[model samples]
Target chain A: MDLLSNLSLGFATAASPENLLFCLIGVILGTLIGVLPGIGATATIAMLLPITFQLEPVSSLIMLAGIYYGAQYGGSTTAILINMPGESSSAVTAIDGYQMARRGKAGTALAVAALGSFFAGTVATLLVALFAPPLTAIALKFGAAEYFSLMLLGLVSAIALAHGSILKALAMVVLGLILGLVGTDIYTGAPRFTFGITEYADGLSFVALAVGIFGIAEILRNLEGDQDRTVLGTSLGGLLPSRADLKRMVAPMLRGTAVGSILGILPGGGAVLAAFASYTIEKRLSDHPEEFGQGAIAGVAGPESANNAGAQTSFIPLLTLGIPANPVMALMVGAMIIQGIVPGPNVASEQPELFWGIIASMWIGNLMLVVLNLPLIGLWVKLLKVPYHVLFPVIMAFCSIGVYSVNSNVFDLYAVAFFGLMGYVLLKLRCEPAPLLLGFVLGPMLEENLRRAMILGRGDPTIFVARPISLTLLLLTLAVLVVMFLPSIRKKREEVFVEAD
Target chain B: MKNITVDWTDAMAGLIFILFGLLFGVQSLGLEIGTAFRMGPGYFPLVLSGILLVLGGLIVFSAIHDRGGEGVGKMAWRGLFFILPAPIFFGLTVRGLGFVPAIFLTTLVAALASFKMRPLWALVLAGAVTVFATLVFSYGLGLPFRRFGPWLEF
Candidate 1:
C-alpha cells in the first residue's frame, strides 16, 4: 500500500522535464553502444559515470539505470541482426535470433524482441516495487557475520559461473581481492598498498578498472581477428508482429519473466543467467524442439524478455542490501555513492523521491526505448554495414579518451591500455573477465565484513555459522560446491560453463 | 586431454600465489602493528597470502597427479605479441604528449598490433582516429586540449 503512494511521488518526480530528458538521452546512448559489438552496458555506464557528477541524484540514477536496461534491449537487436552478440546476456538471443534473420524473418524477430522486452521490463519493475521492501526487511536482520557469509557465497557463485579452468578463475578472484585492498584501510589510518602515490591512496578507481577490463579489453579482443566484420543483409518487412505471433509469444514471455525475476535476485547471476535459463526452459518446453536453433520466434522472445527483465530487477540487490549482483550493479552502486546516496535498507525511507523516482523512470525509459528503437532499427542495420577498417579505430580512440577523461590523467590511459592487454591475454587463455570484475567489486566489501565479523566474535570462526542467515548462506555455498564437484553434476557444470559464451 | 590445460594453468597459478605469499610474509616482518584484533592492517593480507600459498600448493599437487589429459605447450606467441605490447606503448607515450596524444598513439599502436591493415592504411586509420577523437572529446565537449603550435590557437 505504501508502495503505491511512493510510486505516485516517484511519478511526480520522474515526470519533471529534466529527468525525462536525461532518461531519454540515456536510453538512446545506451542503445547505440549496446548495438555496437564489444562495448557493453557496464563499460558504457562506467565511462558515462563521471559526466553525472553534476546532476541531481535521482536524475543521475534514472539515467544510469536507463543505460542498463536500454543496453539489454539494444543487445538483442545486434544479436538478431548479426550473429555477433553485443553483450554476454544477448548470446542466447543470437543463437536463435540470427537464424531467424537469415531466414528472412528479421523484422518479425526484432518486433517480438522489442515487445517482449517491454513486457518483461514492466513486470520486473512491478516485482521490484512489491518485493524490495520485504527483502530489505529480511536483509536488515542480517548481522555482520551474515553479510560476510552472503558475500562468501556470492564469491563462490562467481567462481562457479566462470568459464575455463577453475584455478584460473580463483586466481583472478584472488588478484581482484588484492587489488581491492589497495586503498586506505577503513578502520586503520594506515595505507595498505598506496605505494606513496596520492591517487592510489583512494584505492583503484572503479571506472578505471571497469573501462579497462571490459571496454578496452573487448576492443583488443575484437581487433585480434584479421577480419572483424559483422554480417549484414538488405531486407525490410513489417515491424509489428501479427496476432498469431503474439499468441505464440505470450507463454514464453511470461515464463521468461518469472525465470528472470527469480534469477535476477540471486547475487552473481543476473541478466546473463536469466537469458540462458530462459532459453533452456523454452527449448525444453518447445513443441518443436528442432526449430530452436533454426530461428524459432519463441527462442528470441523468451530470452530477450528474460534478459531485459533481469537487467531491471538486478537493481534490487544493490538498492535494498547494498550488494551488487553484477559489475553493472556495482557501477550503479558507485553512481549512487557519487550522488551521495548510501544504498541500503533505509534508502527508500530516507530518500523516497530518489528511490521511487528511479523506479518510475525505468518504465518511462522502457517506453522511450520501444518508441525510439523501432525507427532506429533501420539506422542500426545500416551502421552494421560500416566496414571494420573505419569502425574499430574510432572505437579504440573513444575508449582511450573515455578512460583518460575520468581524472584528466594520462596514467589512466596507460592503465586502460595495460588492462586491455591483460584482457586480451585472458581471452586467449579462455579466462572469463566477468567473474574477475565481480570479485574486484565485491572483494573489499567482503573483506571488510569478514574482518568486522571476526572482530565482533573475538576471532571465533564459529560466528559465521552461529548466525541463522549466515549459516544458511554458508550451507548454500557448501551445497553448491559439493554439487558442482559431483561426477554427474561436474559434467553438466562444464557444459554450462562453456555454454555461457 | 580433458585435464591437461587445467593442470598446467593450476600449477602456474599456484606457483605465482606461493611467490606472492612468501613476499608478503617477508614484508610483514617489519610491521609493528599489534595483532590484538583478528584483522590488524597486516592481518587480512597475511591470512590471504597464507591461504593463497596453501591453495597454490594444492593446485600444483593436483596438476602433478592429473592423468586425464595430455600436456600442451607453454603459450601462444601470436597472442602474446598482439596483446602484451599495447600497454608498454601507452606507458611510453602518455607523459610527454598528454592524454590526447597518448590516446592517439595508443590507438595507432593497437591498430598496428591488430595486423589487419597495411602500413599506408594504418597511417590513414590513425589520422582518421585523431580527427574523430578531436571532434568528440575536444570540440564537442570543449575539453581542454594542448595543440602542437601557437598558430592553431583560437
Candidate 2:
C-alpha cells in the first residue's frame, strides 16, 4: 500500500528469473542499437513491438523500457568515441564528450557518464514510485472534458517544443491526426478513410506506420550521405577519474538529476530538454564557464545524468494519465494497447504487478547497463564499425518480418513501404515526424473526449471553460501557444536547438 | 540585374500539405457530417482538413517572404532503385518462392545498392542472411511459413 511495500512487490515480480533474463536481453539489444549509427531507440522499439505480443505484458514492458534508457547509455559511448551521437539526447554529450576523448580522457568521460547515469536512474526510479500514485489520484478525477483539455495541452506543448518552424510542427500534428482517422468510425460505424479496403476497416497498422517512417525512411536518408566515420581515440587511456574530476562531477550530476526529474514530468519535456537545460544550468552556475565547449567534466556529467533521469521520468505522464508526452512514450502506449492492457490511472490499481514491475525493472536495467557496458566497451566499439551499407539490408529485413508477423498479412508490409516513402518526403521537407506519431496515437482519444464533452454540455462548447481543471488545462494550452508565437521566445527556441546542431 | 532566388523546400512542403488537405476535404464531403452535439464520422476529419488547409496556407505565405534555407538535396535515386524494389520483390515472390529464396534474392538486390558490395560478396552476404533469417524466424520463432515453396517441389 505504501511506497516501500509497493516497491518490494515490484522487486518480487521483477526479480523472477524470466523477467531478469528478458530485461538483460532487452538492455543488451538496446545497447547494440544505441552504439550503432543511423537507427535509434524509437525505430528499434517499433521493430520489437511485435515480439512483445508473445511475452507477458509486464516482461514486454520491462524489455521495452530497458531499450529506452539502455540506448541513452550506449548513445554516450558513440558520442565520446566517434563524435556521432547515437541518440539525440546524447547530442550535447558529443560536444564536450568528443573533446574529452581528443584530450585523451575518453575512458574518464565514459566512466563518469555511466556512473552518473546509474545514479540518476536510481533516483528517478524512486521518484516514479513516490510520485506516480498521487498523480494517478489526480488523474482519476478527470472527466472527459478535462481529459480532452489535457490532450489539447499535450498536443500544443509537443508542437511548441518541436525543433523547427512552429507552423510546420503544428501542421504535422494535424497531419498525424488526419492519418489516425483511417479506420472505421468509432461512433457511426461508417468508414472514414479506409478507401473501401478491408485492411482500412481496422485502421493503419501502427507498426507499419512507425517502421516505415522511422526505420525505412532513415535508411533512405542515410544512403544519401557517405557511410563512414573516424574514431578519434585508439587507446582508452586510464579508465579511473582523478579526485578532482569526481569532486567537480558530483554537484553537476545531482543538479542534473534534480532538473531532469522535474522537467521530465512536464508534457513534451524529455531527455533532450533535460540534457540541454542541465548543460546551460551547469554553464551559468560554473565558476569557469569557458571550459564548457572545450572539455568540461561537468558538461559531460550533467547532461548525461539529466538525459538518463529525464528518460526515466518521462514514463510518468504515460503511466498515470495514458497520455504520451513524446514519441517513445506513444510507442509504449501502443505496446500496452497491443497487450490488451489499457494504460490509464486505473492501471496502477488494477494491474499493480505490471505498473510496479516495470518501475523496478528500470533500476535493474540501469544497473545492468553499468555492469554490462563497463566490461563490454570493446565489443560496442567494434559494433560501431559495422558499416551502414551492409547493416541496412538486415534492418529492412527485420522490419519486414517483424511487421508481417504482427498481422500475418502482406497489406501491412505494403503500408510500411508507402509510409516509408511518405516519411522520406516529409523528412526532405524538413518536417519532424515525431509529433505526427504522437498526434496519431492521441487522435481517437481526443475525438471521443471532445464529442463526449460537447454532448454533456448540450452543444455549448463552454463546458471546457466551465470546469475548473479543464479550464486550467485549456488555458495552459493557450498560454503555450501564445508564448511559442512570441517573437522573443520563438527566437530563443531556435537558438537552443541550433546550438546542438 | 541582381539575381534573386527563393527557397522551394518549404514551398513544396506547403504545397503538398495543401493538396493532401484538399483531397481529404473532398472525400469527407461525401460522408454525413453531424452537428456539434452528436457528431458523425466526417465531423472531426472535416474540421481537421480545414485546419490543415489554413496551416498549409500559412506555411506558403511565410516561405514567400523567407530569404534563405537550403534547397532540396539530391534525391537518392540509386538508393531508391535497390532499396524500394527489394521489399516489393520479396513481397511478390515470398508466397511462391518461399522464405529462403525470397529473402535471399531480396538481400542480394538490397546489397547491390551499396557501391561497396561486390557480386561475390553480395552472394555470400545474401546466403548468410537468408540462412540466419530462416533459422531465427521460421525455426526458432516458429513463424508459420514454408521454407521452400511449391515451386521448389520439395
Candidate 3:
C-alpha cells in the first residue's frame, strides 16, 4: 500500500500537461539521436544538459529519462534494419536482428524487440519502486570506510566487466583519477595540477570531457570507414509475431527481466552488460543455441528486454545513493547537480515528488516510445540513409555550441579539443573509454572517502577491515579481481565480448 | 607462425602512462606530504601515481610476452586533421565573428574533411546549418550572443 500510494503521487506529478508534453518531446528527440548511428544517449544527454536549466526540475528529469530508455528502443531499430548498432548496448541485437531482416522477418524482429522492451520496462519500473526505499536505508548507514570500500568495489567491477586488457583499464582508471585531481584541493587552499590556469581551478569540465570523448571521438572514428551502408529493404514484412514466436519469447523475456533487474543494481553493471549477459544466458538455455546468431526471435527478444529493464533499474543507485552505476547515470548525476539537487541518500525523504515522479515518468516514456517508434520505424530507417558527410558537420556544429554554452567560457571549448584528441589517441591505443569515464566520475569521491576513513581510524588503515560492511565490500572487490584473472572464466568473458563485437 | 615481436602499441601506451606517473609524482614532491591521518594536497595524488607506475610496468611486461596482433589501425589522419581543428576554430572565432558566422565557418571547414564534399554543397550546407542554429539556439533558446560581432562594425 505504501509503494502503491507513492507511485500514485509520482503519477500525479508526472501526468501534468506540461510534464507529458516534455516527455513526448524528450522521447521523440531521444529516438531521433538514437536512430542516428555514432550519436548516443550519453552524448545527447551531455548536449541537452544546459537546456534542463530552463524547465522545472521534475519535468527536465522526466525528459532526460525518456531520452535514456528511448535510445534503448531506437538503438534496436537501426540494429535490425542496418547491420550497424545505433547504441553500444544494441550491438548484440544487430547480430540476430540483421539476420532476421535479411530473411524478410525484419518487421517481426522489430515488433519482438519493441514488445519485449515494453514488458521489461514495466517490470523494472515496479522493481525500482520496490527496491529503492530499502537501498536508501542501507545507504544511510554507510560511513567513510564503507563508502571507500564500495568505490573500490565499483572500480574493480568496472574493470572486471569491461572488455580487453584489465591492466589497460586499471591504467585508464588511475589516469582518470589523476585528471580529476587537477582542481584545487578540497581540504587545503593549495592547487594540485592547475598549472596556473584560472579555469583549471575548478577541474575539467564534465560536459567537455564527455562530449569530446564520446561525441567527437566517435564521430572521428565513424568517419574513418567508407560510407557504404546497405539497409535491408523498406518492406518490413509482417509486424506481428506468430503464436510460436510469442511462446518462445515468454520465458526469455521474463528471464531477461530477472537478470537485468539484479545486475542493473550493481555499480559497474548497466544496460549494456545486462543485454550481453541476458543474450548469453538465453543462448545457453535455448534448445537451438545454433540459431542464436542467425535470426532467432528469442535472440532479439531477450537482450532487448534485458537492456530496457537494466536501463530502468540502473536509476536505482543514482536516485537512492547518488552512486552512478555507469557513464549514462554519471551524466544524470551531473544533471542532478545542475538542478541544485544533491544526489544522495536523503533524496527520497527530501524530494519525494522528484524521486517518484522520475520513476513514474520512465514508465510513461516507455509507453510513448512503443507508440511513437512502431509506426516511425520507416522514418528512422530513412534517417539512416542520410550520409555521414552531411550528418557529421551538423553534429560537430552542435557539439561546439553545446560545449561553449556550458560555462560560456572559450577555455571549455579548448578543453573539448584537448580531450577529443586525447580520446582519439586512447582509441588508437585500443583502450575503451567507458571504464575511464566511470573512474573519472567516481574519482573525487573515492579520494575524499579514503582520506576520511584513514583519518577516522587514526592512520591505522584497518578501519576499512574493522567495519563489517566495508570489509564485505572490499572482499567482494578482491573476489572480482581474482575471478577476472582466472584463466577459464577469463576466456569465457573474452568469448562473450568477442561474440558481441 | 609469423615472427612474433613485442606488442609495440601496448609498449608505447605503457610508456606513456609511466611517463605521466613519473611527472605527477615529481610534481607532488613540491607539495605538502602530510601523514596518512591528515593528508595534504599531494598525499592522495602521490599514492595514485605510485599505483599507476606499477600498473604501467605490468602492462609493459605483458606486452613483451604477447604476440603482436595488430598495431593501432589506420590512423584517421583526415579526421584528426579536421575534427580537432573545427572546435578550435569555433572557440577562437565565436567571440570575434559571432555565433552564426563562427558556426558557418566551422561547419565549412569540417565539411572539407570529407573527400566527397563539393564546394557548392558545403557552402549551402553551412548556410542552412547557420540559419537553423541561429533560429533555434540564438532566438528560441536565447543563448545571449551577438548575431554579428564588433569586428563586423565598419
Candidate 4:
C-alpha cells in the first residue's frame, strides 16, 4: 500500500533468482548490441520478442526493460570510444565523448558516463515508483479529444525538433502517417491499403519498419563509405574518474537530470532530446564553453546522465497512460500485449508485482550494467577496432533475420526491404526519418480519436476546444509552431540542422 | 536544370499522392455501411484520401516558390540492388525452404549485397544461422516450424 512497502515487494519479485538471471542476460545482450554499431535496442528487442513469449509476464517485461535502458548505457561507450553513435540518443555524447577519447581521457569519459548513468537510473527508478500512480490518475481524465490533441502536439513537436528543412520534415511525417494508415481500421473494420494481402490486415509491423529504417538502412549507409573508420584512441587506461572530473560534473549532471526527467515524459523525443538539450545547457552554463568540442568531461557526463535518466523516465508515460513516448517503448508495449498484459492506468493496480518488479529491476539492472560494462570496456573497445566491412554484413544479416522472425511471414521481410529503400531515399534527400516514424506511429491513433470525438459530438468540431485538456494541448501546439517560425528560432534551428549535416 | 529536377521530384510526389488519393476515393465507393454517424468501411479511407489530396496540392504549390539547393540524383544503386531482391528471395523460398532456412538464405543474400564475400563463407554463415534459428524457435519456444509441404510436421 505504501510506497516503501510496495518497493520492498517489488525488490522481492525482482531479486528472485530467475528474474535476476534474465535481467543480467538482458543487459549483457543490450550492451553487446550497443557496443556494436548499427544494432539498436529497437531491433534487438524485436529480435528477442518471440523468445520472451514463453517466459512469465514479469520476467519478460523485466528483461525487455533491461535491454531498453541497458542499451542507453552501452550506447555511450561506442559514442565515446568511437565517433559512431549506436542510436540517435547518443549523438550528443559523440560530440564531446569522442573528443575525450581523442585526448586520451577515454577512460575518464567512460567512467563518468557509467557512474552518472548508474546514479540517474537509481534516482529515476525511485521517481517512477513515487510518481507513476498519480500520473496514471491524471491520465485517466483524458478523453478521446484530449488524447487526439496531445498526439497532434506530439506530431508537431517531432517535426519541429527534426534537424532538417521544415518542408521535408513535414513531408516525411505525412508519409509516415500514410504508412501507419495501411492496416485495417479498428473502428470501421474496413480493410485499408492492404491491397488484398492478408498479412497487411494487421498493418505493417513496427519491428519491420524500425529494422529496415534504422538497422538495414544504417548498414547500407555504412557500406557506401570507408570500411575502416575506427576511433583513434585504442588504449585502455584508468577505469575511474578523477576528483577534479567529479567536481566539474556535479552541476551539469543535476541540471541534465532535471531536464531529462521532464523532456523524457514528452512523446516522440525522449532520450534524443534529453542528450542534446543537456549538452546545450551545459555548454551555455560552462564558463569555459570553448573546451566543449575539445575534451570537456562535463559534456560526456551531462548528456550520458540525461540520456539514461530520460530512458528510465520515458516508461512513466507508457506504464501510466498506455502512451508510448518513442518507438522502443511502443515495442515494449507490444511485448506486454503479447504477454496478455494490457499496459495502462489499470496496469499498476491489476498487476502490482509486474509493475513494481520492473521498477525495482531497474536498480538491479543498472548495477549489473556497471559491473558488466566496466570490465568489458576493453572488449567493447576491441569491437570498435573491427573493420566495418566485416561488421556491416553481420549487422545486416541480423536485421534481415530479426525482421523476418517477427511474423514468420516473408511479407515482412519484403516490407523491411521496401522501407529500407524508402529510408535510404529519404536520407539522400536530407529528410529526417525520426519525425516521419513518430508521425506514422501516432497517425492512426490520432485519426481514430478524432473521428470518435466528432461522431460523439454529431460532427461539431467544437468539442475539441470545449474540453479543457484538449484546448490546452491545441494551444501549446499552436504556440510551438509560432515560435518555430520566429527568425531567432529559425536561425538557431538552421545552425543545429547544419551541424547535423 | 538542377532546380528544374528538384521541382520535378516534388511535382512527381504530388502527382503520386493525388493518384493515390483518387484510387482510395474510388475504392471507398464500393463499401456499404448502415449509419452515417457510426462510420462505415469507407469513412476513414475517404478522409485519408482527401487529406492526401490537399497535402499533395500544398507540396506542389510550395515547390514553385522553393529556393532550396539543387537536388542530385544520389540514389545508391548498390544498396538498392541488395535491398530490392530480398522480398523476391523471401517469397520464393519461405514455403518450400521453411521459415528457418528461408530466413537464413534471405539474411545471407542480404548480407552479401553490401560487398563481395566468399560464397563458402556466406553458405557457412547461412547454415549456422539456420541451426541457431532452429534451436531458438523450434526447440526453445516450440513454434511449430513448417518442415514439409503446406502442413507442419511438429
Q: How well is each residue in A263-332 modelled by candidate 1, as lDDT tens digits?
A: 8888776687788899999999999999989988889889988988888788888778887888788788
Candidate ranking under DockQ, highest first, comes to 3, 2, 4, 1
Between which residue pairs do clashes occur in model 3? Answer: none
Interface RMSD of 1: 3.7
For all candidates in order, the CA lDDT equals 0.74, 0.86, 0.85, 0.75
DockQ values of all predictions: 0.34, 0.68, 0.76, 0.35
Candidate 3 structure lDDT = 0.85
DockQ of 2: 0.68
Rank order by TM-score, top first?
2, 3, 4, 1
Considering summed lDDT, which 10 consecutive residues are worst modelled in model 3 chain A? A45-54
lDDT of 3 by residue, B1-154 (tens): 5665798778888888899899999889888989998998899999999999999999888898636647788777888898889989999999998888999999998888787788999999999999999999999988988888878878
Instruction: Give the TM-score (vs. native) of candidate 3.
Output: 0.97
The residue pairs in collision within model 4 are: none
Backbone clashes, candidate 1: 1
Pitting candidate 1 against candidate 2, the one with the higher TM-score is 2
User: Model 4: per-residue lDDT, tens digit, B5-122?
Assistant: 2465565556655676687667766665434456665666566667767766776676675365456365556756865566558666767777776667666776566555567777
Please identify model 2 stretches exceeding 4 Å from their true place.
B1-5
**lDDT: worst 10-residue window of model 2 chain A:** A225-234
Clashing pairs in 2: none
Expressed as tens digits, the lDDT of each residue in B1-154 for candidate 2 is: 5444555888888888898899889888988999998888889899999999999998887887535779779776777778777767777777787888988988888887777777998888888888899998899889888788888886
Best-matching candidate per DockQ: 3
Deviation of model 1 at A246, angstroms: 1.3
